[model samples]
Target: MKTDPTRYLARLRVTPGYEKAVPAPPSVGVLIVGYRACFAAAPAAGTPIASFEATTPVQIDAGAATAMALISVERATQRLRIRTEGGTEISWEENYFSAFGDSGTQWHLLPVDPSSHGGFVIARGAWAAGGYQAVLTRSTLIQAPFAPAVVSVHNVDPHTGERRW
Candidate 1:
Protein backbone atom coordinates (compact mmCIF):
# COMPACT_ATOMS: atom_id res chain seq x y z
CA MET A 1 0.00 0.00 0.00
CA LYS A 2 1.12 3.66 -0.51
CA THR A 3 2.07 5.64 2.57
CA ASP A 4 3.05 9.16 3.75
CA PRO A 5 4.77 9.18 7.16
CA THR A 6 7.58 11.67 6.78
CA ARG A 7 6.36 15.10 7.84
CA TYR A 8 2.94 14.54 6.27
CA LEU A 9 1.63 17.89 7.54
CA ALA A 10 4.46 19.72 5.79
CA ARG A 11 4.11 17.61 2.68
CA LEU A 12 0.34 18.10 2.48
CA ARG A 13 0.49 21.89 2.93
CA VAL A 14 2.09 22.26 -0.52
CA THR A 15 -1.01 20.81 -2.19
CA PRO A 16 -3.74 23.15 -3.57
CA GLY A 17 -6.37 22.69 -0.85
CA TYR A 18 -5.69 24.93 2.11
CA GLU A 19 -6.93 28.57 2.31
CA LYS A 20 -3.25 29.57 2.39
CA ALA A 21 -0.71 27.49 0.56
CA VAL A 22 1.59 27.38 3.53
CA PRO A 23 0.20 25.76 6.70
CA ALA A 24 -0.26 27.62 9.99
CA PRO A 25 3.07 26.53 11.56
CA PRO A 26 5.14 23.63 12.81
CA SER A 27 2.68 23.41 15.66
CA VAL A 28 -0.36 23.07 13.36
CA GLY A 29 -1.14 21.49 9.98
CA VAL A 30 -4.08 19.79 8.32
CA LEU A 31 -3.75 16.49 6.53
CA ILE A 32 -6.47 14.89 4.42
CA VAL A 33 -5.99 11.16 3.88
CA GLY A 34 -8.34 9.85 1.25
CA TYR A 35 -9.27 6.20 0.83
CA ARG A 36 -10.07 4.53 -2.51
CA ALA A 37 -13.13 2.34 -2.45
CA CYS A 38 -16.72 2.00 -3.64
CA PHE A 39 -19.12 2.51 -0.76
CA ALA A 40 -22.79 1.56 -0.66
CA ALA A 41 -24.18 4.55 1.17
CA ALA A 42 -27.78 3.43 0.77
CA PRO A 43 -28.67 -0.07 1.76
CA ALA A 44 -31.44 -1.86 -0.08
CA ALA A 45 -32.58 -4.11 2.76
CA GLY A 46 -33.34 -1.47 5.34
CA THR A 47 -31.67 1.09 7.60
CA PRO A 48 -28.91 -1.42 8.39
CA ILE A 49 -26.03 -1.71 5.94
CA ALA A 50 -24.38 -5.11 5.43
CA SER A 51 -20.88 -3.87 4.58
CA PHE A 52 -20.65 -1.77 7.73
CA GLU A 53 -21.02 -4.86 9.89
CA ALA A 54 -17.63 -6.16 8.78
CA THR A 55 -15.61 -3.00 9.26
CA THR A 56 -15.48 0.23 11.18
CA PRO A 57 -16.79 3.49 9.77
CA VAL A 58 -13.19 4.66 9.13
CA GLN A 59 -10.19 2.42 8.62
CA ILE A 60 -6.62 3.67 8.12
CA ASP A 61 -3.48 1.64 7.48
CA ALA A 62 -0.12 3.39 7.41
CA GLY A 63 3.47 2.33 6.94
CA ALA A 64 6.35 4.16 8.65
CA ALA A 65 4.16 7.00 9.88
CA THR A 66 2.08 8.17 12.79
CA ALA A 67 -1.61 8.35 11.77
CA MET A 68 -4.34 10.66 13.05
CA ALA A 69 -7.89 9.26 13.04
CA LEU A 70 -11.01 11.35 12.45
CA ILE A 71 -14.71 11.17 11.50
CA SER A 72 -17.63 13.46 10.66
CA VAL A 73 -21.03 14.07 12.21
CA GLU A 74 -22.59 11.31 10.13
CA ARG A 75 -20.04 8.79 11.36
CA ALA A 76 -20.06 9.81 14.98
CA THR A 77 -21.47 6.44 16.04
CA GLN A 78 -18.53 4.62 14.51
CA ARG A 79 -16.14 3.20 17.08
CA LEU A 80 -12.60 4.43 16.36
CA ARG A 81 -10.01 1.68 16.34
CA ILE A 82 -6.19 2.07 16.15
CA ARG A 83 -3.16 -0.21 16.27
CA THR A 84 0.58 0.15 15.60
CA GLU A 85 3.18 -2.35 14.46
CA GLY A 86 6.97 -1.93 14.08
CA GLY A 87 10.14 -2.11 16.12
CA THR A 88 9.78 1.42 17.52
CA GLU A 89 7.44 0.40 20.33
CA ILE A 90 3.89 1.55 19.78
CA SER A 91 2.42 3.94 22.29
CA TRP A 92 -1.18 5.22 22.63
CA GLU A 93 -0.93 8.81 23.75
CA GLU A 94 -3.79 11.17 24.51
CA ASN A 95 -4.57 13.60 21.71
CA TYR A 96 -7.27 16.05 20.64
CA PHE A 97 -10.15 15.60 18.20
CA SER A 98 -12.48 17.95 16.40
CA ALA A 99 -15.30 17.97 13.83
CA PHE A 100 -14.30 16.49 10.43
CA GLY A 101 -16.53 15.57 7.53
CA ASP A 102 -17.87 16.86 4.26
CA SER A 103 -21.68 16.42 4.58
CA GLY A 104 -21.91 13.77 7.32
CA THR A 105 -19.10 12.01 9.18
CA GLN A 106 -17.78 11.59 12.76
CA TRP A 107 -14.04 11.60 13.49
CA HIS A 108 -11.69 10.82 16.39
CA LEU A 109 -8.05 11.70 17.15
CA LEU A 110 -5.22 9.93 18.97
CA PRO A 111 -1.40 10.10 18.80
CA VAL A 112 0.36 6.92 17.66
CA ASP A 113 4.10 6.27 17.92
CA PRO A 114 5.02 3.39 15.65
CA SER A 115 8.25 1.44 15.91
CA SER A 116 11.19 2.00 13.56
CA HIS A 117 10.19 1.08 10.03
CA GLY A 118 6.88 -0.20 11.33
CA GLY A 119 3.22 0.41 10.43
CA PHE A 120 -0.17 1.16 11.99
CA VAL A 121 -3.90 0.64 11.39
CA ILE A 122 -6.84 2.85 12.44
CA ALA A 123 -10.44 1.98 11.70
CA ARG A 124 -14.05 2.29 12.90
CA GLY A 125 -17.51 0.79 12.35
CA ALA A 126 -20.54 2.91 11.54
CA TRP A 127 -23.36 1.94 9.22
CA ALA A 128 -24.24 5.54 8.51
CA ALA A 129 -20.62 6.74 8.48
CA GLY A 130 -19.74 9.33 5.90
CA GLY A 131 -16.36 10.50 4.45
CA TYR A 132 -13.50 11.20 6.87
CA GLN A 133 -9.81 12.28 7.16
CA ALA A 134 -7.15 13.10 9.76
CA VAL A 135 -3.60 14.38 10.43
CA LEU A 136 -0.74 13.98 12.85
CA THR A 137 0.06 17.06 14.92
CA ARG A 138 3.18 18.02 16.79
CA SER A 139 2.02 20.79 19.13
CA THR A 140 -1.72 21.37 18.50
CA LEU A 141 -4.42 20.65 15.95
CA ILE A 142 -4.91 23.27 13.26
CA GLN A 143 -8.33 24.17 11.96
CA ALA A 144 -8.45 26.06 8.66
CA PRO A 145 -11.26 28.13 7.23
CA PHE A 146 -10.99 26.26 3.93
CA ALA A 147 -11.17 22.57 3.05
CA PRO A 148 -8.88 20.57 0.77
CA ALA A 149 -9.97 19.60 -2.72
CA VAL A 150 -8.78 16.48 -4.57
CA VAL A 151 -8.34 16.45 -8.34
CA SER A 152 -7.56 13.27 -10.26
CA VAL A 153 -6.21 12.96 -13.82
CA HIS A 154 -6.92 9.81 -15.80
CA ASN A 155 -4.74 8.69 -18.75
CA VAL A 156 -6.24 6.12 -21.08
CA ASP A 157 -3.07 4.79 -22.78
CA PRO A 158 0.27 6.48 -22.12
CA HIS A 159 3.49 4.87 -20.96
CA THR A 160 4.87 8.27 -20.00
CA GLY A 161 2.05 8.65 -17.39
CA GLU A 162 1.16 12.16 -18.55
CA ARG A 163 -2.28 13.73 -18.17
CA ARG A 164 -4.15 13.67 -21.51
CA TRP A 165 -6.19 16.75 -20.69
Candidate 2:
Protein backbone atom coordinates (compact mmCIF):
# COMPACT_ATOMS: atom_id res chain seq x y z
CA MET A 1 0.00 0.00 0.00
CA LYS A 2 1.59 3.27 -1.15
CA THR A 3 0.25 6.63 0.05
CA ASP A 4 0.90 10.28 -0.61
CA PRO A 5 1.94 12.14 2.52
CA THR A 6 0.55 15.41 1.22
CA ARG A 7 -2.76 14.15 -0.11
CA TYR A 8 -6.11 15.12 1.40
CA LEU A 9 -8.64 13.81 -1.08
CA ALA A 10 -8.92 10.06 -1.58
CA ARG A 11 -10.75 8.85 -4.66
CA LEU A 12 -11.91 5.27 -4.86
CA ARG A 13 -13.54 3.67 -7.86
CA VAL A 14 -16.82 1.84 -7.34
CA THR A 15 -16.97 -0.66 -10.11
CA PRO A 16 -20.23 -2.07 -11.36
CA GLY A 17 -21.10 -5.76 -11.85
CA TYR A 18 -19.25 -6.94 -8.74
CA GLU A 19 -22.31 -8.13 -6.90
CA LYS A 20 -24.51 -5.35 -8.22
CA ALA A 21 -23.94 -1.89 -9.68
CA VAL A 22 -24.54 1.13 -7.51
CA PRO A 23 -27.82 2.79 -8.36
CA ALA A 24 -27.06 6.13 -6.75
CA PRO A 25 -24.17 7.96 -5.16
CA PRO A 26 -23.28 6.47 -1.79
CA SER A 27 -23.14 8.54 1.38
CA VAL A 28 -19.54 9.45 2.30
CA GLY A 29 -18.49 10.49 5.80
CA VAL A 30 -15.20 10.94 7.56
CA LEU A 31 -14.26 9.84 11.10
CA ILE A 32 -11.60 12.30 12.07
CA VAL A 33 -11.80 15.18 14.51
CA GLY A 34 -11.04 18.64 13.12
CA TYR A 35 -11.74 17.29 9.66
CA ARG A 36 -13.67 20.38 8.69
CA ALA A 37 -10.91 22.56 10.10
CA CYS A 38 -8.51 20.87 7.76
CA PHE A 39 -10.64 20.22 4.68
CA ALA A 40 -13.69 22.32 3.80
CA ALA A 41 -15.35 20.03 1.27
CA ALA A 42 -14.82 16.84 3.25
CA PRO A 43 -17.72 15.19 5.03
CA ALA A 44 -18.28 15.69 8.74
CA ALA A 45 -16.57 13.20 10.97
CA GLY A 46 -19.21 10.78 12.17
CA THR A 47 -19.38 7.83 14.52
CA PRO A 48 -18.93 4.40 12.99
CA ILE A 49 -18.08 6.40 9.87
CA ALA A 50 -20.60 7.00 7.05
CA SER A 51 -22.43 4.41 5.01
CA PHE A 52 -21.48 3.93 1.36
CA GLU A 53 -24.51 1.83 0.56
CA ALA A 54 -26.82 3.05 -2.15
CA THR A 55 -30.60 3.36 -1.85
CA THR A 56 -31.05 0.78 -4.59
CA PRO A 57 -28.31 -1.47 -5.91
CA VAL A 58 -28.08 -1.00 -9.68
CA GLN A 59 -26.61 -3.62 -11.94
CA ILE A 60 -25.28 -2.04 -15.09
CA ASP A 61 -23.15 -3.48 -17.83
CA ALA A 62 -22.12 0.02 -18.98
CA GLY A 63 -21.30 3.47 -17.65
CA ALA A 64 -19.01 4.16 -14.65
CA ALA A 65 -18.98 3.84 -10.89
CA THR A 66 -16.92 6.27 -8.84
CA ALA A 67 -16.72 7.79 -5.33
CA MET A 68 -14.50 10.13 -3.37
CA ALA A 69 -13.56 10.23 0.30
CA LEU A 70 -12.24 13.45 1.79
CA ILE A 71 -9.98 12.84 4.75
CA SER A 72 -7.50 14.72 6.96
CA VAL A 73 -4.65 12.97 8.68
CA GLU A 74 -3.57 15.23 11.50
CA ARG A 75 -1.55 12.41 12.95
CA ALA A 76 0.87 10.33 10.93
CA THR A 77 1.50 6.62 11.24
CA GLN A 78 3.83 4.11 9.66
CA ARG A 79 0.97 2.51 7.81
CA LEU A 80 -2.62 3.47 7.01
CA ARG A 81 -5.21 0.98 8.15
CA ILE A 82 -7.81 0.02 5.54
CA ARG A 83 -10.67 -2.26 6.39
CA THR A 84 -14.02 -3.04 4.81
CA GLU A 85 -17.19 -3.56 6.79
CA GLY A 86 -17.54 -7.06 5.35
CA GLY A 87 -14.23 -7.57 3.58
CA THR A 88 -10.54 -7.99 4.17
CA GLU A 89 -8.60 -5.29 6.05
CA ILE A 90 -4.98 -4.34 5.49
CA SER A 91 -2.40 -1.68 6.28
CA TRP A 92 -0.36 0.12 3.64
CA GLU A 93 3.03 1.71 4.12
CA GLU A 94 3.57 5.35 3.25
CA ASN A 95 4.99 4.75 -0.23
CA TYR A 96 4.94 1.03 -0.78
CA PHE A 97 2.83 -0.61 -3.44
CA SER A 98 0.27 -3.33 -2.74
CA ALA A 99 -2.52 -5.09 -4.57
CA PHE A 100 -6.11 -6.12 -3.80
CA GLY A 101 -9.13 -7.63 -5.49
CA ASP A 102 -12.63 -6.31 -6.14
CA SER A 103 -16.02 -6.88 -4.41
CA GLY A 104 -17.25 -7.56 -0.85
CA THR A 105 -17.73 -4.93 1.83
CA GLN A 106 -16.94 -1.20 2.05
CA TRP A 107 -13.67 0.08 3.58
CA HIS A 108 -12.66 3.23 5.54
CA LEU A 109 -9.92 4.48 7.83
CA LEU A 110 -8.98 7.85 9.34
CA PRO A 111 -6.32 8.79 11.89
CA VAL A 112 -6.21 12.41 12.94
CA ASP A 113 -4.02 14.28 15.40
CA PRO A 114 -1.78 17.33 15.42
CA SER A 115 1.38 15.24 15.72
CA SER A 116 0.86 13.00 12.69
CA HIS A 117 1.75 13.41 9.01
CA GLY A 118 -0.48 13.02 5.93
CA GLY A 119 -0.99 9.97 3.74
CA PHE A 120 -3.01 8.85 0.72
CA VAL A 121 -5.61 6.08 0.45
CA ILE A 122 -4.56 3.42 -2.05
CA ALA A 123 -7.31 0.99 -2.92
CA ARG A 124 -7.83 -1.58 -5.66
CA GLY A 125 -11.34 -2.53 -6.66
CA ALA A 126 -13.21 -3.74 -9.71
CA TRP A 127 -15.55 -1.75 -11.92
CA ALA A 128 -17.34 -3.87 -14.49
CA ALA A 129 -14.72 -6.57 -14.22
CA GLY A 130 -11.93 -4.11 -15.10
CA GLY A 131 -9.23 -2.18 -13.24
CA TYR A 132 -8.66 1.55 -13.00
CA GLN A 133 -6.33 3.87 -11.13
CA ALA A 134 -7.67 5.87 -8.17
CA VAL A 135 -6.18 9.20 -7.16
CA LEU A 136 -6.05 11.49 -4.12
CA THR A 137 -5.54 15.23 -4.33
CA ARG A 138 -4.57 17.29 -1.29
CA SER A 139 -4.08 20.48 -3.22
CA THR A 140 -5.61 21.57 -6.47
CA LEU A 141 -3.66 21.42 -9.68
CA ILE A 142 -1.92 24.66 -10.38
CA GLN A 143 -2.07 26.40 -13.74
CA ALA A 144 1.11 28.27 -14.62
CA PRO A 145 0.32 29.77 -17.96
CA PHE A 146 3.17 32.28 -17.87
CA ALA A 147 5.68 30.14 -16.01
CA PRO A 148 8.33 28.20 -17.89
CA ALA A 149 8.30 24.43 -17.82
CA VAL A 150 10.50 23.19 -15.00
CA VAL A 151 12.70 20.21 -15.74
CA SER A 152 14.74 18.41 -13.05
CA VAL A 153 17.69 16.13 -13.60
CA HIS A 154 19.46 14.12 -10.91
CA ASN A 155 22.91 12.63 -11.45
CA VAL A 156 24.03 10.40 -8.56
CA ASP A 157 27.49 8.97 -7.98
CA PRO A 158 26.75 5.24 -7.83
CA HIS A 159 29.24 4.38 -5.07
CA THR A 160 28.74 7.44 -2.87
CA GLY A 161 25.01 7.95 -3.48
CA GLU A 162 25.71 11.67 -3.87
CA ARG A 163 24.15 14.00 -6.38
CA ARG A 164 26.39 14.89 -9.29
CA TRP A 165 24.00 16.99 -11.31
Candidate with top lDDT is 1
Which candidate has the highest TM-score of all?
Answer: 1
TM accuracy, model 2:
0.17
State TM-scores per candidate: 0.21, 0.17
lDDT (CA) for every model shown?
A: 0.26, 0.25
The all-Cα superposition gives candidate 1 an RMSD in Å to the true structure of: 20.0
lDDT by residue (tens digit), candidate 2, 31-150? 111111221122332312222222011211112222223222222123445566555545534324223322221222232222212221222221111221223232311211221122
Question: Model 1, 39-86: lDDT tens per residue?
Answer: 212111112211211122233333223233222123222334454653
Q: State each model's C-alpha RMSD to the native.
A: 20.0, 21.1
